[model samples]
Target: MNQGTPRLAVLATAVVIGAAGLAGCATGPVDRRALCTGFDKLGSELMSANGLFDNAVFASAGDLADLADRYQGGGLSADATALERISDADATNGFELERATSGTAKVCGHPLGLGTTSYAETGSGSTQANGGYGSYGGYGYSPPTESVTSTAPEPPTSSSPTTPAGDEVSARATLQQQVDTDRTQVETLADKWVPQLSSKNHGLVAHGTTYDYRAIWADFTATRQAYPSALLLWSGDYTSYTKGDFWVTVANQSFPTGAAANAWCVAEHLDADHCFAKLVSHTHGPRGSTLPR
Candidate 1:
């Protein structure tokens, strides 16, 4: 070997060792003290940002500190961050609502018409005068006496077995008729509207309004402040943005009629330009048709 080769080998070995040491240090057990300190800081920031500490459950500083310790110990940093975000959003929304309604709204200002205090006082006096008070100074209201009202038992009435058979046939016929009618209406509506609204700017990619169904659902949910419903339908099957999953659902509900559905869409704050007010009949299938009914 050349005289300079040994020196180069030694330097290379040292470099490798140094890199390994740095990596080991980086991935080593976390410093409990530092973790606890970070958690305390995060808790303070969250409490100040959301004012959750005003509630008795969250008021104790020690309770927050303990929660921080537990979260850090469990390696739940992402969950902690998400909880903070939700709390902050709720606080911001509540603050805005309070500001908007302050000093302008009053509740329960009118006197209650029925069962007023004067009526109660007079009734109580009348009851007292009637010796309704017991010796123990308690009200002597007795349970009502049982009334024995009786009538002759009528003979048992029987219907022929044919009656039930006929009823079953009638019910089946009605159900079949309804199904056929619904199917025809669904097909007609689908054929009519599916081609026209398929590519509209509602973020749908289907053959018609069905393409924008999820977006429409989401918009309706958000407009109505139906977070739970939106979460249930559009949130999909994801854990959440911060958790292992990429998203979380928030809400879900079905409307009874087209007008009711439109009203809900409007209340939920969906865009008026999106043709949200239009009623579309939905068929029952893998990909339901959103056609005008």
Candidate 2:
């Protein structure tokens, strides 16, 4: 036979003898031959039980029946109970291991090796050790820090020119004039379109004057065509009892005026009446009107 096999057999024999001696010390004198037989049987049962457990835990369907047979041949009844307990423990642990593995794989976007936590480092050098089992790059690795260069501030070049008070007043007047011109254009467009509506609806009341939706739409369209810098919000179907259909709405920031609101509707390409009825200004009132309950 192989030299290693003999050495292993000798070592096993020595272990069995030592175990029996310890048992004898605990109890009374034990028959060496009987104890040796028991040891042999116990060793075989332990090996078979362990193999069965490993197979079940790893989802490997091996010759479990054969292993079970060897386990049954063990000297004590407790051996069977011990085997069952081991199998139970392995099954429970295996289920937990599978769940933990799957969860970590999904969250970390990678598979974890055996006995590894979800936050375990991926080969990509990103550490996921800080978070829980499913957390990626938890406490194990540090984030990269970017180097910042500090520069001395440059001295002021020449003294900046200061505008006279009269010049500042002129600039303000010019800005107000532009504002007024834009407002007048918006009003004139409303006047042209106000008569087209079937209902004698008053124009949008802002800053004390009513502006027609069509006029606002014209001005909004013109502005968009010219600058194309207006903020566009989303438009979609809005169902309500009073309003038949909801259209697009736009705003200077979000939804500043009726014109901006109508602009949003037109951009979204929704029906005008539907968009107006569904506007935020119309939503505050009672179920049928613009007044809040």
Q: Highest lDDT: which candidate? A: 2
Best by TM-score: 1
TM-score of each: 0.19, 0.15
Positional deviation of residue 175's Cα in model 2 after best superposition, in angstroms: 1.3
lDDT of prediction 1: 0.27
Segments of candidate 1 deviating more than 4 angstroms: 1-66, 69-72, 91-283, 289-293
Segments of candidate 2 deviating more than 4 angstroms: 1-167, 191-260, 263-293
> Per-residue lDDT tens digits of candidate 1, residues 35-76?
333333433343243323344212322332334334323543
Residue lDDT tens for model 2, 218-266: 2233223322333221111122223221112222223434465445545
- On the 0 to 100 scale, the lDDT of residue 190 in model 2 is 26
Once all C-alphas are superposed, what RMSD does model 1 give against the true structure? Answer: 28.0
